[model samples]
Target: MNLQDLQWGLMMMVVGMGTVFALLALLMVVLMGIGRLDRKRPHLPPPPAHEAAPAEATPTVHIVADGLDEDQVAAITVAVMTHAEHRRRLAAPETRAHAPGSQLFASRWLAVGRGRESSPFPRERR
Candidate 1:
């Protein structure tokens, strides 16, 4: 072949070899990326366990209340119970014992007249 034809053939060969080399390089990079992904390790702490506080020794105390008797205890209990019941009633709306014909129930709405007869409002307690 002539020098021009030989020159063209050489150029073609070089370009073909260059294309093959570029593909090889690209495959090597892809393989390296896959290896790096597989080698990647996720760092995480283990699940927590129930840990209890150590027991402590506190001083034992014995207290004796003076000047208290059965009558005082009964009175105190009754007062406290009554107060608690009052608070319980006040916490919610006060409810009346349902006695429709009772004198106490009848006396309240006498001033307001029969217009309030159908009402179920709680009695105004003292």
Candidate 2:
């Protein structure tokens, strides 16, 4: 409508926006501090978290086995790696006791020869 009304509306909007932004920034800072705290002192390690003893234990699945085609083995390794990562992500360590997905990521890396025990490369890189 009038310039004065517009100015008032704009000023109010600016104040509202500034307040919302300040609150959001404060929240972000708090979360970052909490994240740093969590990193500094993790409640529990990933593999076997601190929880009530379960009736059964987790089984370690081995991938080192005599297989048919080389392609098949490669494909299987890739699949296992993907599966492990997905599983780890699906399970949170502290709340859920453990995450298998993290191990899956490790297994995937291992399968791809990025781990401690890896398959020999066909030829040296250039």
Candidate 3:
């Protein structure tokens, strides 16, 4: 291609790149301004706390223990507690500590790398 044609292409490339860069910078500035305005905007005060109702105003539930023996009651209580603990564990969010396949490595740090693991001790010369 001619030198003039190459120069025109370079100019066009520069203008296109500059336009994209300018637009992105302007978007960043507008977002920052919006954030600043949001911070400055007045917020409604927290709702006032209402006093709790008197104990006498609430209804109570009673359980009869006449039919259940001590052993049966204890068994039922254990079963209920175990079920609750199981449910709690199931409902909890999965953490990195309990990630699947994590058990293969002794530590999370050991699980990541592109090459052979490094050692603190100096290697023996071949």
Candidate 4:
């Protein structure tokens, strides 16, 4: 290539790279300005006084099951506790005692389809 052509290509390359870097720098500055503005704004007001009373902490319950090791028991306990907490949050305060039936001990495979017709992948579909 001629010297002039090479110089022109180099100039174009520099201009393109400079444009990209300028845009990125401008974007960063804009984002930082927005963050500073957000920091300057006042914090949100606290929740209304009527709803401000703290919720009562629920006591932990333990389950003793036969034939389960300590690790299994711990896992089951955590799962049950989390489920109970979730249910309590969703239920009305007046009907809080309504414990749902325990599916924790239920067999998952009992209702699973066992026949060839129940296969997830069928050759015909493929």
Q: Model 4, range 43-119, lDDT digits (tens) per residue? A: 79987666533565565445456867667898989998898788768884554554465545446564354434477
Q: RMSD in angstroms, all models? A: 17.6, 24.8, 18.3, 19.8
**Stretches of model 2 off by over 4 angstroms after superposition:** 41-126
User: How many collisions between residues are there in candidate 3?
Assistant: 0
Off by over 4 Å in 3: 40-126
Query: C-alpha displacement of 19 in model 3, angstroms?
Result: 0.5
Name every residue pair that clashes in candidate 4: none
CA-lDDT, candidates in order: 0.75, 0.74, 0.75, 0.75
lDDT of 1 by residue, 48-70 (tens): 86665556545544432566666
**Residue 50 in candidate 3 has what lDDT?**
79
Window of ten residues with lowest summed lDDT in model 2? 92-101
What is the alpha-carbon lDDT of model 2 when measured against the actual structure?
Answer: 0.74
Q: What is the TM-score (0 to 1) of candidate 3? A: 0.32
Candidate 3 local distance difference test against the native: 0.75
RMSD of 1: 17.6
Ranking of predictions according to TM-score: 1, 4, 3, 2
Q: What's the true lDDT of residue 94 in model 3? A: 38
